[model samples]
Target: MSRRSLLRGFSGLGTAGALAALTGCGVPAAYVEAGDRSAADRSARDKSLVFANWPLYIDTDDKNTSKRPTLDAFSKRSGISVKYTEEINDNDEFFGKISPALMNHQETGRDLIVISDWMAARFVRLGWVQEMDRAKQPNVAKYLDPQLSSPAFDKGRLHSVPWQSGITGIAYNKKRLGREIKHTSELWEPSLKGKVTLLSGLDEAFALLMQGDGVDITRWTADDFHRMCDQVEKYVKNKQIRRFTGNDYIKDLSTGDVLACQAYSGDVIQLQADNPDIEFVVPEEGAELWAESMMIPNLARHKSNAEKLIDYYYEPEVAAELAAWVNYVCPVPAAREVLASSKDKDTAELAEDPLIFPDDAMRKRLAIARDITSGERVEFAKRWNAIVGL
Candidate 1:
C-alpha cells in the first residue's frame, strides 16, 4: 500500500485507542500535520550546495581517503561544488548550533543537511526547511523507497529524502548469551539482568522497548507510554540494563560487557565483520525502522545545485557505491542489482544480506515509530530522562 494511504488508515483511530494499541506493539502511528504547509522564500541565487552529514556516512575512495569519488564526479558533471561538512556529532547539539540561525531568519550556512527523522520532524514542524521542488528531482520521486515517502513526520514529499534506512533490533554476542535470542522478551529474562543496554537518546530507544510488551507502536497512547515507562523503572531498579548509550553500545556488545542490547542494523553489519559471533534479530514482537534524511535548510543560496547533487546520488551506480561502503539500508531499489554484479565476493554477498535489502520476512517485522514533535519534546525528554537517570 502507498505510505499515505497506510498512515491515513490510522488517522481514524481515537487518541486513547491509538495509545492503547501502541503500548507494547512496534508499529508507529502516522503523523498528520495540524496546519498548512510552511511557505518558503524561493527567490535566491544558486551555485554551490553546502551539505552537512554525519561522520563516515558517504563512500570514500579506498586508496585516497580524502576523495568521495561519487560526489566528486557529481561536482564535475553537474558543475556543483558540494561544500560538504561533517559537523553533526550529537542530534541535540547540532540542533542547538543551528536553532539560533533558523530562529533569527539567517542562513544555517548549509544548503542541505542529514538528520534523523525524529529531529527532521522538529525542523519541518517549525518551517525551518524549504519544501523540495520534486519536479527538479525526478530521480527521487521515481526511485525513493515508497515506504519512506510519507513518513509520520512529513506526510508527502514536502521536506526530506531518506539518505539511508536501518532497523533497531536486538544485537547479542552469541558466545556470551550461549543461545540465540529471537525476541524482545528474551532480553527481559532474568538471565540477562545487567547484561543488556538501551539507547540513551529517547528517540533512538523507546519504540523497541514498547514492542516487548506487545504494544502496537503505530497507535500507542499516553497510557501505553506510561506503562512502558513503569516497566523500564523495574528494570532500572534491578539494574538489569547496564546503561543507555549511543554508538558506545557497539563497544559494550563487542567486549562482551553487554550480552544483548538494542542495535541498529547498519552498525551491526559492520560490527559482525570484526566479531562474527555478534548477531542481530528483529525480535518476534517487532522492531523500529529509522532513517537519517536529507533536507534543504531554509534560505540556502544554492537550491538548484543542491537538488542536482541529491539526484546524482539517486542513480543506482552511485547509490550502490555508497551502500557498499556505509553498509546501511539502501533506499534505491535498483542498487540491489548493482551490488549483486560486484566481482568481489564480499560485495556480492552483501546483496544477499537481509539487513541491506530487508527481505519480506524482515520487512514484516519492522515499523517506524511516532516522532516526538516540538511541543512534545520537553515532556517526553523529561519522562524518559527520569527512567535513564540522564
Candidate 2:
C-alpha cells in the first residue's frame, strides 16, 4: 500500500462506534494512572529496543532497501540493537492490536512506536504512553522545531516527539492553469469549476479549509467549522468540486484531470521531481502544519535505550540525512546548514527547499491546528464525514 494510504487509512478511530467507546457516557475504564504507566528499566541488560512504525517512513539505503542508514548509525554508535518492525499500517487497527496489553498493565513487547498526533492524543489522554526524560534527550531539547515544541494534546511534548512534519496545503499545475493561486478562495473561481478536489478524511480535510476563511485554527470554534462545511456542501452540489480524494489526488494533478487539490507537502515534493509544472503553495490566508510523532509506550522494557535513539535522530547531521531521503519538513531546524554543506549537489540543494526547511515568511503562515477534542469528535466528524461522503 502507498504511504499516504497507510497514513490516512480508515480515519483511524474516527468512526461513530469508536467515538462512542472513546468519549461516550462516563469516563472510560481504560484510563491508566501515571504511577502504573511504567515498567522496570532493562536497557542496561537488554542492549536492544523494538520499534514499530509505518512503512517507508524512515530513510533507507539507496543500494540496499533493507538497510536504514540513520538507524544503522545509531546502532553502531550506541551498540544498541534495534528490532524495527513496520507493523503499524492503520492507527485504529494498531490500537486494537496493543490496547489489550496496555490496559491490562502488561508489556506490549515493543519499546517505541510512531503514530499520527491525533491518535497520539488518544494514547496520551488514556495515559497509555510514558513521558520522556528530557535530561537524557539533550539533542532534542536543543534542535527540535519551535513550531512543533508544543501541541494542544501533548502540551510541551511530555509524551511524544515528532517523527516527521508535513503541510496540508494547496497544490496546483501552474503551467496549465496559466496563473498563480495565491489564496484559497481562488479555487472557487468559475474558471476552475468542476476541476478541484479536497481530502476525504475529516481529520485530514478541515483545518486548511477553515484557514481559507480566515479562522485562527489554533483556537477555532464550532461555528467556524459549521461555516466551512456549509461552503463545501454548496460547492459539492454544484459540481465545483470534481471529487474528494485520498493520496489519489497525485494522479489527478499529474494528468491535468484536476487543476488544484488539497495535498501533502512531502508527496508534492516527489511529484515535482517528475513534473516541475506541479507547484505547492501555502496560501496567503494560511495552512495547517501536522506531524506523525514518536512515543514510548507504557511498560516498555527498554525505555532508556529508546530515549537514546530518539535523541540520536535529533542531531543535525543525522536529521539532514533523513530529511534528504524523506522530503518532509525537518523537525530539527538546524539541519538546514548540515544539508547546505553537503558534497553531493542534490543533497546540498535540498537545504534551500522551503518545503523541507520552511523559511521565515512561510513559518509565519503555518500553524498547527488544535486537534478535534473528544467532546467534539462525534458531532464534528458526523457533519464533516457526511459532506465528504465517507
Taking the tens digit of each residue's C-alpha lDDT, what string does model 1 give over 1-390?
111101111111122233334443643332323232232433244446679988788878879978998888987887667778978765556766776566556688788898878778877766778777889888898888776778877888578988888888889999878999988878888999999888776777789988888988777777777888888888889998888776777778888889999888887888888899999999889999888889887777777777777887888888888888888888887899999999999999989998888888888888888775545556666788778766
| Residue-by-residue lDDT tens digits, candidate 2, 1-390 | 235544552543343364356445443437899999999999999899999999988889889989999999999999999999999877777887787678667899999999888889888988999999999999999999999999999999989999999999999999999999999999999999999999887888889999999999999999999999999999999999999987789889999999999999999999999999999999999999999899999999999999999999999999998899889999999999999998999999999999999999999999999988777887887787788777
The worst-scoring run of ten residues by lDDT in candidate 1 lies at: 1-10
Worst 10 residues of 2 by lDDT: 9-18
- List ranges where model 2 is wrong by over 4 Å: 12-16, 19-29
For candidate 1, the clash count comes to 17
Error of 1 at 94 (Å): 1.3
lDDT per model vs. reference = 0.76, 0.89
Per-model C-alpha RMSD = 8.7, 2.1
